[model samples]
Target: MNTIKVFIVRENDGSYSSYMDEQANLPYGLVGEGATVAEAMDEWNRAYNDMKNLFEEEGKEFVEAQFSFAYDVPSFLLYYAGKLTFAGLSKLTGISAAQLSQYANGYRNPSPKTTQKIQNALHAFGNELSQLQLV
Candidate 1:
């Protein structure tokens, strides 16, 4: 199955958006925007299905793909805020909670180096969770 990469980003107005970059190279562009991540994703999925139906009606070949959603730093932070507190994330990434909060609130953008730091930390945490066993 073909996998399409979809990026979810937080807009300056605190809304969310889901979109495919040009690199996806699809015949049509797909985009969705909403006040939250879930809504944006739902709209994006609906857009895809609507496009597929249009293609069928036009007798055109529609490419079937599974979408892999990736989140921008702010979006990721905001989306997971309830589960992962800034203080906890700070410990994992060795960054201050205030700095993390600034990033999450879109008051500041992380440097590439800092972004990588966060990514590596999260991946390591996920690896740890993957190794867990039940009693």
Candidate 2:
């Protein structure tokens, strides 16, 4: 099992910052100054959701268990694991929901930075179904 790791940093403003080094590449939130841990957590959820939507938009497949190309995991494995809604993802990832919808529907694609950020958000639970033994 892959366990996700996270760290907290205190800011000069007396708020906090959360760095999620798991599969997700981008950090979760800055708790410094006026932000509370709750706020940071809210940010984390929002960011994570957006990345999940990114995967969905990309036409990726997701596998719920150990699967082979024959059995197959959905290319969007992380998306499933993350349990994100498209609107939610947009709110968190800062990408327009419409754009994300286009990506998921296969009308468009996300940029490199977007891809990296999405991966960062999924880093903790990166490989979901692949970890299964049957594949």
Candidate 3:
């Protein structure tokens, strides 16, 4: 499976758009846009397959590959806000709810330290959950 790194950008219209950061010699200008990150990812996958098929039909080398998506902070927040609210994330991250809300809304960017803090907290939580056993 070949993985493409996606860079998510928040648009002014409150939609998320993604582009392939490393095309690995593939054609240029592969982009996806939607109201949510998941939608944008689905769009990107469709576009990628369409392009790959076109190359194969044209007698060009088309390698079948599976893609895994990656999300940026704002996009992640927006996409998972239904599952985890800003307040919930703040509790886990030790970041203030107000700040988390700002980050979720694309009004502010988190510093590298803050980003690391959030990632670490999420990892810790995921580790704890992995150890759970049903009664």
TM-score of each: 0.86, 0.35, 0.79
> What tens-digit string does per-residue lDDT give for candidate 1 at 20-64?
966887888889999988899999999999999999999999998
* Comparing 1 and 2 on lDDT, the stronger one: 1
| Model 2 weakest 10-residue run by lDDT | 64-73
lDDT of candidates 1 onward, in order: 0.92, 0.47, 0.79
Instruction: Rank by lDDT, highest first.
Output: 1, 3, 2
TM-score of 1: 0.86
Quote model 2's TM-score.
0.35
TM-score order of candidates, top first: 1, 3, 2
* C-alpha RMSD for every candidate: 1.9, 20.0, 2.5
Mark the regions of model 2 whose C-alpha exceeds 4 Å error after superposition. 22-34, 61-135
User: Which segments of candidate 3 are over 4 A away from where they belong?
Assistant: 22-25, 63-66
- Model 1 regions more than 4 Å off: none
Model 1 clashes, total count? 0
Model 3 TM-score is 0.79
Q: What is the C-alpha local distance difference test score of candidate 3?
A: 0.79
Question: Candidate 2 lDDT, tens digit per residue, 27-79?
Answer: 22212122655565566556556655665788654221110111011224222
